[model samples]
Target: MAAVWQQVLAVDARYNAYRTSNFPQFRTQYIRRRSQLLRENAKGGFDPLLRRQYLKLRSQLLAQRYGPLSEQSSFRAYSNSIRSSRTTLDRMEDFDDDLRAQGARGHRRSVSRGSYQLQAQMNRATYEDKSPGSVVPTSVAEASRAMAGDTTLSENYAFAGMCHIFDQHVDKEVPKVQFANDDKNRLACCSLDGTVSIFQLVPTPPAVLRVLRGHSRGVTDFAWSISNDVIVTTSLDATMRIWATEDGKCIREIPDPDCSEVLCCTFQPMNNNLTVVGNSRQNVHVMNISTGKKVKGGSSKLTGHVLSLSFDSPGRILWAGDDRGSIFSFIFDMATGKLTKAKRLVVSEGSSITSISARSWISREARDPSLLVNACVNKLLLYRVVDNEGTLQLKRTFEIQQNSSPVHSIFCPLMSFRQGACVVTGSEDMCVYFFDVERATKAIVNKLQGHSAAVLDVSFNCDESLLASSDARGMVIIWRREQK
Candidate 1:
C-alpha cells in the first residue's frame, strides 16, 4: 500500500508536467492519457489501482478547474453567479421575481457565467404593455410557434403610439440611436450637430442623462461596448473618440491615420477591446482601443468610400459596405485582430451601400443566417448566408424609397414567436417600414408615419418594449409596444 501510494504521487507529478506544458490539450485528453500512464507504471496490479488513481486525478483536476471546495470560495462563486444572473436578467421583464426564483434554485446555480448567457439568449415571445416582453419556448419547435402563428409586424407588434419625442439635436440630422446591449432603459443617439445625447427611460418620464460634445464636425456613428461602460464615436472631424459612459468624459481621441473623415465604427461583438473603423479614404482599419493603435495586418482598402460596417454575432465575420454599392465580407481573426477579405457583392454600379446587418439565425424554424442590406437602389435586400466564408445569396428584396441618404435598418431584436422573420428600416419617404421577409406579395407589414423628414435610422430595445427611430430633421421618436 505504501509503494502503491508512492506510484500514484509519481503519476500525478508527471501529469502535472504535461498540463503545464500544454494546458488545452491536457484538459481534453487528460483521462485517456493519465489512464495509460497509470497502467504502464503499475502493470502487475492495475485494476483497483487504476480506479483509485483515475478518480483521484479527476477530483484534483475538477478542484483546480473550479476553485477549491472551501466555504469562502464557494460563497464567493455563488455571489458572482448571482450577480451575473442579475445582470443578464436586467434585460428581461419581472427580473426581480426571476432573481428570487434563481436564489431558491440554490445548488443548481453552479454553472459558469458563460453558461447562463447561453441559456439567456432566446427569442422574446410575449410582453406586457408596461414591461419589456417575456417568455421563450423551451424547445425550438415551441419557439417557432410560440406567439402569433405568423410573422407579420402588424400581427406581432401593436405600437400604441409615440411615447416621447426628443429633439435634443434640434435642426441637425439625427443619424443614429441605439439602446445599450445590456441595459434596456438606457440609450444614446448621435447627430450631425456634432454631439451625442444619452437618455434614461425609467422613473416614469424619460429624459436626457448627459450630452457628449467634442467633435469639430458632425458625429457620423457610435457604438456601445458590450459591458456598457464605454462608447466609441466617429466624426467628420477626421478623428474617433472613446468616452466613459458613467461621466460622459472623452478618454482617448485617435486621429485617422489617413487624415480623412472617419465615417463609421463598430465594436467587435466577441471582443470590445478591438474596434473596426471606416474612413472616407476607402480604407477600413481594425483598432486596438486599449493602446490606441492600428492592429498589424488589420487594415484593408475598398473600391469606394467605406460607408457602413457590421459583424456577425460571434465576431468571426465582418461585412463592410461602400459608396460604390458593393458589400465586402472579411474573415476576422479573433486572436490577432487581423482581417482577410473573403468575397464581394455588387448590387448596383452608381448607388451607395448605406447599411448592413448580419444575423446568425432568422428564426428557430428557418435557421438560415441572413444579412439585411440597405443600398441606395430603391430596395431593401435580404441575403442568405450559405457558407462560413460569409458568401451571400440574394434571398429577397422589399421596395423602399431609398435614394441617397445614409439610411440604416435593423433586425427586430426579439424575433416574434412565429414562422416568419421581420426587419425594420427607415425610408426616405418620411416613414418607418417593417417588412415580413417571408411574405412575397405584401412584404410591407406596417408603416409608421409622423416623421417630418426622411427617416434615417431605426432601433429596438432589448425586449421589444420600445422602438426608437431618428430622422433627417433631428427628431427621435420613442414608440411604445401596445399590450393586448
Candidate 2:
C-alpha cells in the first residue's frame, strides 16, 4: 500500500513540474512573431517618407490593376449610399433622469462626487418618434408603407430625443451648435457666457468634455477647421480665437481693434490656413491662421453689417448675407488668396437677413440646380446661382413661424443643413421643418416638434445620422433615427 501511494505521488509531482517548466517556452513560441514585429517598429530604422511613397506606389498599382469604377456606376452607388447604412443602434431618451436625481442626493448628503457617476445608469431611447405634423402609421405594414410613401420631409425624419440640460454650468442661451465635421462624436456650442463648450456624444447622454473659455464677451459664430483639429470662433469681444479641440486650448487669437466686433467667421474652402471673417462694420477680414494676421490683399467690404456668410468651394466665391437682406458675392482668387467683390443682389427691401447656407456645385448642371438658402426675418428664400457671373435668381420662398432668436444671435438667421439631403430649420412656433430641395416643388416633408420654446440653431453631424438643435431658452436636443 505504501509503495502504491509513493508511485502515485511521484507521477503527480512529475506531471506538475513538467507542465510548469514548459509554460514559458509555450508562451515564447506563441508570441515570438508579435515580439519581433514590435521590436522592428520600435527600432525607428524605417523611414516614414519612403514608406509613404511606397504606400502611394502600391495604391497606384492596385488602382491600375483593379481600374476605376464607371462614372455612371459611381454616381448610382453614391446616391444609393445616401439612404444610410442599416444600424440596429437606437437612442435611449431621458437616460439621465435617475442619474440627475442620484447626483442631487449626493450633493445634498455626505458622499464623494464619484457617487454621482451617472453613465452606467443611462440608456438609449428605442422606437421612432413621429413629429407633430408627421403621419403616424397604424400597423407594421402601414409603417413600411409610410416609410416608402413619399418624398415629403416628415416621413423621412423622426425626433429622436432631447439633450440632457447642462444648464447648471451656464445661464445664457446656446446660439450655435456645430458638429465637428472630422469627428462625429463631438459637438461644439457657442454660448453667450463668453465660452465655447464642446460636448462628446457616444454612451447614451453626452458629457461636456471641455469648456473653451477665452472671449471676454459672447461667442457668436464658430466652425470646425477643415482638418477638424481646430475650432474657430468669432465673438463680440472683437476677436476670432482658434481653439485646439483635443487639449481645449486656444491656439491662436485674431483681434480686430480697427472694428467693433467680429460677427461671423468661416474657414476658406480652398485655403483652410486662411480664415474669412465679417465684422459688425463694413470690412470683412481674411486672416492667415499660421501668423494670426490678416492676409495681404484679403480685406474686403460690404455696404451693410455682414450678418451671415457661406463659401462656394466650386465657384471660389464667398457669399455674405447682410443686415438688409442683400446677398454679396466675393470672388476668392486662389492664386493671390484674396477676396475681391464679385456682385451683390438684394432680395428683400427692408427684411433683415439672418442666415445663409450655400449649396455645393450642381453635379448634373442642367438637371440639378445649385441653391443658396437665405433666411430673412421669418421667411427662407432659395436662390439659384445662375452662372460664373455669380448671378442669383429667386427660386423658392419658405415661410417659417418667425424666428425670435436675437438678431445678433447666431441661431436666429440660418437653419443649418450643410451635409444632408434636405434643408432643416426651426420656427418660432417651436417646430423643426425639413424642406426637400431635390423635389421640383420643394415639398415640405416634416415638421418635427420637441422643444417647448423657439429653437435657435440646428446642425447635423457628419453623416447626418445625428442632429443637435439649440433653442432660445438654452436647451439643446439631439435626435437620431429610430432605425438606420
Candidate 3:
C-alpha cells in the first residue's frame, strides 16, 4: 500500500511539472486536434481518460493565461469539451451501474471515491463555470445559481441600480408612448415630434420599416387591433387617425365630438370591428370602425377621470382605471347594448393609475385563463378573476412597491414554457425589472438597463424568445436570450 501511494504521488508530481512547462502548447495542439475530430465525428467521439486529461490540462493553461481575451477563448473551448464529455459519459454509464448492483461483475472494479462527494464536486464546478457552453444538470437551484453568476446578469443589475431623475431632460421632455402588436412581430412608437415609427423585427437584423406622419400634435396613445393590420393613434390635438400598417397610409380620421383630449383608445379584443375610446370626461364610447359610426351604445361614466383601461378575456371583463386611484369593471352585452357592473376595486391611496395590461395566456387547473395585471403610480397590483355564484369577482391583490420612481409601465409574459410564470416591469426610473410571479414575492430574477430616459413600454414576443423595450428618447432595444 505504501509503495502504491508513493507511485501515485510521483505520477501526480511529474504530471504537474509537465503541465507547467508544456501545458500551453499541449492545449493548443489538443484543441486543434479535438476540433478536427469533432468535425469528423459530429456527435463527438473521445475516450474518457483522454477527455479528462484534456480538461485538466486546459484548466491549468487557462488559469496561467488570465486576461480578458485569453480567458474568453480558453473558457469557451474548455466549456464545450466538458459538455461533450459529460454527455458521452452519461450515456455510456446509463445501465452499467444497475447491472453492477444486480450482482453482475463488470470489466473494471468500482472506484473508491464516494458518489456523494463526486456529485458535490460536479455541482461546484458547474457553479464556477462561466463559459457560454457549460453543461449543468437540470436542477432549479443550480440553474438559479448559474444565472446569478452570469456576467450579463451582473452588468444589467448594475445598470438598473441607477435611479430615475424626473425632469432629467427639460429640453427633451417630449412624452413618448409605445405598443407592440398582438403577434409582437412589430413595435410602434410615437414621440412628441409628430412622428410614428414602426419597427419590423422578425428578421435577423431588425430595422425601422415605416414612419407614419399624420398627427400634427404630440401623439399620446395608440393601440393595435387584434388582427394587427390597422393601428389607431390619438394625439393631444384632439384627433384620432387610423392607418394601414403595411404602407403607413392614413385610412380615416375620427374627430372628437366635444374636442376633448382623447386620453386613450383600445380595440375590443372580443369584438374585432368595434373600438372603445376614452377621454378626459370619464366616459367610454364604443364605435364601429368599418362603418365609422357609433354602435348606438350609450356611454358609461365611471367614478373619476379615466386614465387607462384593460380587458380580461376569461371573465369578459373590461377594467377602467381612473385618476382618483379607483378601478371599475364592467361587462358589456353587445346585442342588448347594456353594461353590467362587476366590481369597483380601489388600487392605491393617493397615486393615480398610469398603465394597465393583462398577463398573456396561462395554463391553470388544466384550463387556460388570462390574468389581469394593473400598474398604479407607485404600486403594482395583480388580481385573478374567480367565478362566485356566476358573478366574476376580483380574488387577490399582489402588491409590489416602487421606492425609486413611479411604475410607468408593467408587462407580464410567460418567459419559459417550462417555468411557471414570469413578469417584467419598467418604471420611470429608467430601469427594467424581472420577477417570477409563481414565487409570489418581489425577488428580482434579472434586470436590464440601457435607456437613459424613462422606460415607457415593454413587450415580449409570442414565443417569449425576445423582449422589446422603448424609452422616452424614442430608442427601442430588443433583448434575446443568449443561446447555449
Candidate 4:
C-alpha cells in the first residue's frame, strides 16, 4: 500500500508545473482545443441561448395559429378587458359590442302613446260602474243581466249566470268555446264537424255571424287573437288554420310536420303573429303565423298527449296538461315563440288535465305571485308561480270526495263585481259545481243543473257577470248573474 501511494504522488507532481501560470502559451493552446471539441459535441445540439430563442418563436407561432377567435362573445369581452395596449378605436368597438349584448339580453317591448291612451280608455270602461257604490249599473252590465236572466247566487258563490243552449252541436262531442278579448259578446267555437261557429252573444239570443269551414277533420281548439280580428284553430287533420274572423275567411292552413293530429293550441302571449300547437304525441311546436314556417329551435315535448295549456308572458313560462294527468312546464321565448327548459310532473294517475287558467285570467286573483288553476279528473289545483320563474308551488286544492266519480275537465274562474272568488267545473252527473277558490276548505258551494249530459267546457267573461258552458250533446249555455 505504501508503494502504490508513492507512485500516485509522483504522477500528480509531474502535472503541477503545467497547471501554474508560468505556462501561458500552453494554457492558451489548451483552451482553444477544448472550445473546438465543445463546438463539435455529438450529444446536445443547440446551446442554451439558441434553444431559448427557438422555444420563444415556436410558442408565438402556435398561439397565432390556434388561439380563440376574436369575434366570439366571451373571447371579445375578455380581450377587451385586457386590451389596454390596443388602439383606442379597437377598445371603443369592444365597448359598443358589450353594450349591444346587454341591450339584447334585456330587450323589452316599447309602449307607444297610442297604446297608453287605449289602455286608459279600457281601464275607465272597465271600472266606470264597478268601482264603488254607484246607484245604477253600467249599461253593459245591465244589458248582460237582462239578457241572461238572474238567480240569487249562494252566499259563498258569485252569480250563477243563466244557462241555456244556443245551438245543438250536430256531433256528439262537445266543442271548445272562447269569447273574444276586445268584444266579449263575440264567441268563437270549434265543432267536431270541421266547422267553426261565430255567434254574437247578446239580446237573449246569439245571432250567427259566419261559419268558417276549412279543416278536413274535426276542429279541436282555437284562440281569438288579441286584436280580435283573427281566429286560429287546430284540427285533428294535422293542420292549424288562420281565419279572418270578421268575414270568416280562411287565410291559411298551416300543416304540422308530423301530422300527428294537433290536440290543442293557443296564441303566443305578446305576438299575434305566432301560434303554438300541441300534438297527440305530447310535443309542442311553434309556427310563424305570417310566414307559415315552423320555428326551428325553441320547443318542447311532454311525456303525455297535451290536452290543454296556457301561457304566462311575464314569467316566460308555459304550462301544459296531458292525457296522463301530467303537467309540463317550459321556459318560453316571447320574441321567437320557442319553448325550452322543460320540466314534467305527474299530478293525477289517469285523468287528463282538462283545463288551465292563469291567475290574471281568474277573477280578482293575487298578482304578486302568479297563480294557475288546473282541472284534473275531479279536482281543482291551484299552483303559485314563484319569483316569476315558472316554479309551481301547490297553494291549494278543491275537490268533492267519494261518490263524485269524475268531473268534466272544464273550469271557469271568475271574479265578481263584489270581489267574490269562484271556480266552476262540470260534474259526471248532469250538474255544474262551483267552489270557492280563495278557501282551503274545499267544500262544494253550489251545483247548477241545466245540461242534460256532461258539461265538457266552461268559460267566464272578463267579469263574473256571465258563465258559458258546452255539453257533450254540443249544447252551448250562457249563465248570467242572478239579480239581487
Candidate 4 residue lDDT tens string, 1-484: 2112222222222222234468644433333233223323412454555544544564355346544323222322322222211112121222233335557899533334323432343233322223232212233332123222332225525455564557746445555777775245768677787888888877656677889998899888898876577889998999999999878899998988677898888777655567788899878887788899888775677778877878763436778877777887777775666678566667776667766665443211123233445445455676665544466667667663212222333334323322234456665566777865544464566777777776666666644556777766777787776645
> Which prediction has more favorable TM-score, 3 or 4?
4
Please rank every candidate by lDDT, starting with the best.
1, 4, 2, 3
Give the clashing pairs for model 1: none
Number of the top candidate by TM-score? 1
Enumerate clash totals for all models, in the order shown.
0, 11, 0, 7
Give the Cα lDDT of each candidate: 0.74, 0.57, 0.51, 0.58
Candidate 4 weakest lDDT stretch, 10 residues: 82-91
Q: What is the lDDT of residue 103 in candidate 4?
A: 70
Which tens-of-lDDT digit does each residue in 1-484 have in candidate 1?
A: 3234333433343333235454543422343344335434554565676657775886578568644555322432332222223222222212223444577887244334423433443222111111111112212233235324434457567688899999978799988999987366889999999999999989769999999999999999999876677899999999999999899999999989899999999998766788999999999999988888999999999999999999976577899999998999999998899999999998898799999988522233333567899999989998877677788888888999999988999888565545556789999999999887767688787888989999999988866878999999899999987765
Considering every candidate listed, which one attains the maximal lDDT? 1
Q: List the residue pairs that clash in candidate 3.
A: none
TM per candidate: 0.73, 0.64, 0.59, 0.63
Question: Candidate 3's error at 324, in angstroms?
Answer: 1.1
lDDT of 4 at 440: 45
Candidate 3 Cα errors over 4 Å, as ranges = 1-184, 202-204, 336-338, 364-377, 388-411, 414-416, 440-442
Please give the distance, in angstroms, between residue 251's alpha carbon in candidate 4 and its true position after superposition.
0.4
TM-score of candidate 1 against the unseen true structure: 0.73
